[model samples]
Target: MSTITLNDGSPVPWLAFGTGTALYGKDASDFVKVAIENGITHLDGAQMYNNEETLAAGIKASGKPRSELYITTKLKILEPGQTATEALRVSLRKLDVDYVDLFLIHSPSPANKEGKLKALWEEMEEIHSQGLAKSIGVSNFRVEDLNVILEGAKVIPAVNQLHPYVWKAAQPIYELCKERGIVIASYGGQTPIVRAVGGPLDAVLPAIRERLEKTRGEPVTSGQVLGKWILQKGAILVTTTSKASRIKEFLDTKNVPDLTEEEVHVIEEAGEKLHKRIYMRHVFE
Candidate 1:
């Protein structure tokens, strides 16, 4: 399996199965079962999604040993008077797992985004120390949010999940993550194509896809091209597909040759022309 070695030396698969808003509380188990059967072993979930039981059920249905799977979930909110540790314990009960391979603070605290970031991160560090979470990270966190955490952080986050598709490249934070050995788990790696269908990439991707298919001797897709771009940048991909065929297409990207550096530049350069942001909402809102 292709994996990225996190800061703590644990491995996370390059292709992750995601349980996002659309699948919350509905058929998460069924699709997760599909994902597992199709060779997906990493699951990305969250406490805010209200579907931990569904995800838990999916894992049970797959019958894959807990040790064989890499599971990740996040702390959705820090309610009034609730500590980060307390919030995670509630998630543990819902997930029915003693320890998540990766746990994250879902986002910067919206109410007082900067005021509490450092302290919340410290609390996350404590959860990691207790072995309740094997690794700790953050999601949808921008560069400014990170500056505060880094000030007094005893443990640097192992990963940072961000929406870095097309125009929303998140360069500053992306560079910061690399300099610090923080693995990036890209959630919208393929969203631009999904949203743009016949947009800018269509003009250039068909030829690149054709060239790559020749290189690998297998059918290559625009989705795969986008995935390959993310992969070539040495980032992990968080993607979801409810259909079996689509799941296979996602895994198939592994066999193809890496996109040339120029090709990657071309795609991003094209994306820069169509700057847009997705996944900008705070879950608490």
Candidate 2:
């Protein structure tokens, strides 16, 4: 597996496995084992997912040493009269881990965004300095909100997890994070295409078939093509599924093809013109 070094100089696998609402119970357990066996060392989870128990079971079942895995979990924004530090402690208990490799502020909800992010970020910095988390980051933050945090931040965020796909490049925020030496970890890597007019598989297969028929090219799946594009863009790609087969397919990084610069340019132009977003919300409003 390819790797990206965090601002803290810690190496994380480029293709991390995510656990969300869809991954649970036996399915998650099997998928986790399959992913690790297939060379995936990074795992992403969140407090809001409500599947940390099952995720822990899967990790224990995999029997991979904790040192071999890069586990990430998000801190839930606190409710009225609640505190961010308390929220993080609750997440830590649910994951059954004393420390996480990375901890991200899940979303800039109203509860945490009405000038509370500055305090939350300060708490995160304290967590890192105290060795409770190896790194800290934010998810779904736009450029403006990012600037708010950066303005008062003593510790720079190491990662920005956001929705990024073929039709949603998020270039402004991507560029901003790059300027600040932050790693951009992308979800929805192929989801937009997968959930498009045709299924994810069908969408790419026909194009490959057409290209082969026209130019005598070899075959490749849409998932692989999309994954390769994300790698080319210099962001870590994250995906989650309950299927063991699917997890194994994602971990099959060998022989992955690269997108030509022209092809990449075409994708960027098309994506920019489309401007589609699956998860849209105002962070500071």
Candidate 3:
């Protein structure tokens, strides 16, 4: 897997095993072990996941030295009167780790915007300075929100993890992050699965699928095509699956199919035309 160097000079693996769903105890431990065994060097978690203990146990089961893995966690924005420092401490206790490779602000909350986020950012800078976290970042932040943080920030955000799938409305933010040297990590590569499971695949309508199939010279599913497109666009892709076999399938990016320049352009144009926001809209608003 390729690695991207952060502004702080720390290298983070491009592919990460994201554990955002509810999984705890033995189930979480097993999932982490399977992920590590399958060559995943990066593990993503968050305080809101509510399964840090099991995530830690899975790390222990992997038997890989703690130094060998890039562990990432996030701070949930506090309720009124709560502190970021307290949030970090609770995350530390739950994960049972002395330090994490990266810590991100989960979203741009009201608390986060009203001076508290600056306080949190400053505190995160202190954490980085004190070696509790190697780097700091934010998730679901638009370019404008990012600029707000940048104004008061001493440390530049190393990563901006967001929902930037091929059929989504994040191209402008992706371009902005690229220009600013911030690595963008995308979730939701399971467009096909969503379609198969009777969920929406809005941008990948039947006509678009037919066009992609004709261009690619194979019956390409929207998920695979979008995943391939994301890689071609130079963004790190993150995906998760509950089924072990599906996880293996996602890891098999070895023989990545290529899309011609014209084909790529067509897809990009189609994406712009049909893009829909997948995740909840509260973050962007």
Candidate 4:
């Protein structure tokens, strides 16, 4: 798989293995090792996930050199007077890594009550300068939240990680990130199929799948069609699955035939028919 060059000049895999709520507090070493075995070099973790210890276990199990892995972790909710530097120091100890490929502000302060975005980002830049992190970015940030940081940020955020489900995708935010050279990482890569199980895509996805299967001379699943849609949109994908077979299916999306122009529009049009958002616990609210 090819890597997406970030604005900071760092490379991240187009597909990432996510240890979100699904693997929270579980021994993910086995899962992590499985992901690595299946060509998933990017592992996404977070302080809030509370699974870094096991995350480390998985990395160790993979037995790959640290240099070959692209690790991403995020700072938890910012407390008053908190700094990204100190936060990252704590995370480093937990992950047992001297440096991470990417780090991020987990979320904006509750309605930005503490008003620490400027202070946090300044320290984030400082952390990058110290070589603690290769790139710095944000998660769950709306356009208004980013505007506040853009006002004084010297280093443009390297990426923005959010749900970005097709139905509820905010096109303006995607375009905004594109303009700023901030790559988008989507955590909800399979949401279109998982949550909207029988939605409009069901009607058309099967036909698209048949066309792809015939062209590729292999089996095609609806999930791959959705994954291709997200991949074609230039957004990095972070998908989580405990099953090995499912992991292979997701990684194989790299080989799936590209969606036709008309097929792409069909997925988007179906998404607009019903907007379903799964992430609602926003600190920015």
How does each model score on lDDT? 0.83, 0.73, 0.71, 0.83
Model 2: number of backbone collisions: 0
How big is the positional error of residue 201 in model 3, measured in Å on the Cα after superposition? Answer: 6.9
Look at candidate 2 and tell me the lDDT of residue 36: 78
Better of 1 and 3 by TM-score: 1
Q: Write the per-residue lDDT of candidate 3 for residues 1-285, one digit (tens) a residue.
A: 377787778888767788884352225778888888877888888887878888888888989888899999988757676666677777778777888899888786664557566667787787778888888888887877777777857898888888753345587778778887888777765543462334344444455556656765756555666666666776667776666665555555423456667657766665555444566467664
Flag the better candidate by TM-score, 2 or 4: 4
Which residue pairs in candidate 1 collide?
Answer: none
For residue 130, model 1's alpha carbon misses the true position, in angstroms, by 0.3
Model 2 root-mean-square deviation: 3.4
lDDT (10s digit) by residue, model 4, range 1-285: 478889988889998898876887677788999899877899999998888988888888889889999999998875566666877888899889999999988777663566767777788889988999999998877777778888868899998887756444567777888888988888876776787687777788889999999999999998888888888988888888988898889888989999999999988887777666676454432
Predictions ranked by TM-score, top down? Answer: 1, 4, 2, 3
After aligning candidate 1 to the native by TM-score, how far in Å is the CA of 167 from where it should be? 3.8
